[model samples]
Target: MHVPDGFINAPVSVAAGVVAAGAVAVSLRGARKELDERAAPLAGLVAAFIFAVQMLNFPVAAGTSGHLLGGALAAILVGPYTGVLVIAVVLLMQGILFADGGLTALGVNITVMGVVTVVVAYALFRGLVLILPRTRRSVTVASFVAALVSVPASAAAFTLVYAIGGTTQVPLGKVLTAMVGVHTLIGIGEAAITMLTVGAVIAVRPDLVYGARGLTAPLKLRVNGELVDAAPARDFTPVAARSPKKVWIGGLVAALVLAGFVSFYASASPDGLEKVAADKGFDKNVEEHAAAGSPLADYGVEGIEAARLSGGLAGVIGVGATLAVGTGAFWLVRRRRTESAGAQV
Candidate 1:
């Protein structure tokens, strides 16, 4: 959920900002090891896809809707550190370009939606994969469960943040209850989308899926009454020999279709956080977004009378901008890794 301005006091917001900054710094260092040639470009496409899917809000309850928080999906497809950066890129773009999330609340949104979700989802996903049967289906199952839990985890994080810095005097128990309850319903949708997307990727190119790596159980052969380790797959292709361009192009096209056209049919109901805020009486103090006057504010192009065309154009622009920024960041990280290696020579 995108926390608007005035929802949290200035001191707490600034404190959260510091925490967000530190997390990003740490993630950037970690991402250096994760963003190789194969993953660098896909990471950007993942960000754009997340940005697009988030626009297609699905109905969760009466007058309430939910969309992909995307931490689990991104972490499953890419590495966790890169997943955090990808989500941060989307949040930053939304705040500055579309006026969707407030600039002042950027830290809150990133902390809850990006950092907390990615950490919790990846941790749970790894744990489950280790215990369950090592198969592609198991990976998808783990992804579903991880995504299901991540949404409520994010809601709980928001509750904790609000308890410390909520502008209104809403009771903590009520806020926690409502937030968790609504988000739990939202989690179902999140799990479904994550399972399908991760499953699809695993089916096509399991090699590209970060979470699915090493998931295949080692082969066993019967050798003279004793079991022995079988040789590795002979058909396996080297990473350097494979091109990610096909997957990248397919993913980009899917994202364009989802945001440019399918988004028009998304539910109009307010999302889980907005609904809870209104129900809990904290919505009254919400301030206008600082970038509300931007041409692309609220995912619509300025001077475009047709709702469909304006929204489509805004969505396309958002996808392009997010892809550009995310790719640049990941490419820089990859370059730094190379330079560091060269210096060790």
Candidate 2:
């Protein structure tokens, strides 16, 4: 949920702002270890894809809808550290470009949606991977569970933040109950999306998925009535650089369809967050977005005759901006990794 400026007191928001800044700083350093040549570019595409998927809000309840949060999906496709950075970039783009999330609430969103979801989901995913059978299917199963749990975990985090700095006098218990209850259903959708996407990528290029790395189980061979370790499969070298042409082009095309064409039929009702805020009276304090006057403020270009063209152009611009920013950040992380590797060599 994108908390607007007046939802939280200024002092608490400022404190969260500091924590968010420090988290990004630490994540930048950690990403150096996780990102490489193949992953760096994919990371950018992940951000753009997430930006796109979030626009397709699915119906969750009678009048409220929800969308994929993408933290678990990103972490499973890439790595946890880089996953955090990727979602952060997407959120940043949505905030500044589309006036979707509040600028002041950036820290809160990152803390709840980025750090909390990635940490919790990845920990659960790794734990499951270690205990389950060593197979690509296991990775897919773990991804499903990870995505299922991450959404409610994020809701709990937001509850905690509200407890700390909530400006409204709403009952905490009701808020928590509603938030978790609605988000659990949303989590199922998140799981399905993550599993399908991760499964597809792994099927095509398992080498690219960090969670699926080292998928081979230890080989058992009998030597003279004694079990002995069998020779391993050929060591997998990082695949040669090829254009991300297929996946990137497909993703861009899907994004265009969702935001450009399908969005016209998306429910006219407010999403879960807006519905909750209205029911709870927390929305009364939301100030107008600073970019409310921007041509793309409402996800449509001004003076455009056709809704399709206006929304399509805005989506294209969003995709371009998100990819540029995400790729630049990941490239920096990959460069750092290269430098560190050289120094050690």
Candidate 3:
């Protein structure tokens, strides 16, 4: 859930901002090991896709809705460090451009939605994959379960953060219950989206899936009375042969479609956090977004009168901007990695 301004006091907000900054710094270093020429562009696509999917909020309860948080999905597709950066980028863009999340609350949103979710989900996913069979189905199962757990984990994290810095006085028990309960429902939707998206990528290009890598069991051959490792294939496909551009282009098209068109049909209900705040009487302290005057505030173009067209254009613009920024960040990281390696020699 995107936390707005004034929900948390200035002291806590600034503390969270410092924590967020440190986490991003650490993640940037970690991402250097994760990103290479092959996966750098895909990381950008993952960010754009997450940005688009988040716009399509699905109904969770009668008046509550939730959308894909993208932590698990991004972690499975890319690596955990890159996943954090991807989500952080999305939150930054949404806060500054779309006014979907408040600029002052950017750190809170990134900490809860990006860092916590990615860490918890990736840990669970790695653990499950190690114990389960090394198959695509197992990977998908792990993705679902990890995503399911991540949402509630994020909710719990928010509860703890609020307990420390909530602007309004409220019963901690009720806040925890409502936050966890509503987010648990939201977790189902997150799991479904994560599972389907991870499954689809695994099916098409298992090589591109970061979580699925090293999952294929070594081939065994029965020779005489003992089993022996099978010989490597002589005519395997080369990395160059499987160009990422195709998948990149395809993913961009899908993101554009989801944000620019399908988003119009998404539920208009308040999301889990908004609903819980309103119910718990803490919503009154929420302040207006700093970027509320932006042309693309609330995901609508400034001059467009048609709701459909305005929203569509805003979505498209968001996708484009996210892609550009994300790709640039990842490419820079990749270049740094190359330069570092060369210097070692």
Candidate 4:
């Protein structure tokens, strides 16, 4: 859920902002190892894909809607550190361009939605992977469970933040119960999406799937009627790397179609956070977005009469911008990694 401004006081906002900044800094360093020339560009596409899917909010109970948080999906596909950066990019784009989230409350949104989800999902995902079979199916299964739980985990985090600095004193117990309960339903959707996306990618390119690394067991050879581990093949080239263009292009096309056309059909209801705020009476403190006057405010272009055209254009623009910015950021991170390796050599 994208939190609006004034929900939390300035003090808490600043504190969260600090926390978010620190998380980004840590991710920037950690991502160096997770990314290379191939993965860096793919990470950018992952962020843009998240931006597209988030627009497809589906109905949940209590008249609330839930959409993909995408932390688990990103961490499983890319890496945990890069996943945090991915969500941060999506949040920044939404806040600034579409005004989907409050600019002042940006830190709260990033911490709640980005860092918490990725950390929780990746931790649980890794744990699951360790216990399960070393197969592609197992990876998707882990993704499913981690993604499902991450929603309520994020909700619990938000509840804790609100308890600390909520402007309107909603009963803490009531808030916690409602937030966690509704988000549980949202978690189901998140799980399904993560599982499918991870499975699809792994099916085509397991090497590109970070979590699927080492999933392929050692090649077995028959020697004296007994199976033994085969020696490593030298000068091996991964077939997946050869078709980077296909994966990137296919992902971008899917994102464009989802955002440009499918978003119009998304459930037109308040999301989990908004529904909770209104029901609990804390939404009274909500303030108008500062970017309300922008042409792309509220996910619609200004002066566009047709709902379909305006929203479609806005979604397309958001996808394009997110892809460009996300790619640029990861490219820098990858470059730094290359420079470091050369220096060491």
Question: For residue 205, what is the lDDT in candidate 1?
Answer: 81
For 1-345, candidate 1 gives per-residue lDDT tens digits of: 888998998999998899888889999999988887667779989999999999999998889999999999988898999988999999999999999887999999999999999999999999999999989999999999999999999999999999999999998899999999999999999999999999988777888899998776566899999998898878676854698888899999999999999998999999999999998899889999999999999999999999999999999999999999988888899899899989999
217: Cα error in model 1, Å: 6.5
Q: Whole-model Cα lDDT per candidate? A: 0.92, 0.83, 0.92, 0.92
Residue 183 of model 3: what lDDT?
94
- Residue pairs in candidate 4 whose N, alpha carbon or C atoms collide under 3 angstroms: none
For model 1, the stretches where C-alpha displacement exceeds 4 angstroms are 217-236
TM-score per candidate, in order?
0.95, 0.90, 0.95, 0.94
Decide which is better by TM-score, 1 or 4. 1
* TM-score of decoy 1: 0.95
Query: Can you write out model 3's per-residue Cα lDDT over 99-185, one digit (the tens) per residue?
Result: 988788889999999999999999999999999998888999999999999999999999999999999999989999999999999
What candidate 4 gets wrong by more than 4 Å, as runs, is: 217-236, 239-241
Residue 345 Cα positional deviation in candidate 4, in Å, after optimal superposition: 1.2
Q: TM-score for model 2?
A: 0.90
Residue-level lDDT of model 2, residues 1-345, one tens digit each, is 666667777777888888888888888888887787667778888898888778777887878888888999888878988888988999898888888878888888888888888988999999999999998889999999999999999988888888898888898898888889888988998899899988988777777888988885456899999998899778565363655567666767776676666766666667666777788877778888877787787677888978878877787777778888998888878988898999999
Give the distance in Å from residue 249's predicted Cα in candidate 2 to where it truly belongs.
3.6
Q: Could you tell me which 10 consecutive residues in candidate 1 have the lowest summed lDDT?
A: 232-241
Better-scoring candidate (lDDT), 2 or 4:
4
When sorted by lDDT, best at the front, the candidate numbers are 3, 4, 1, 2
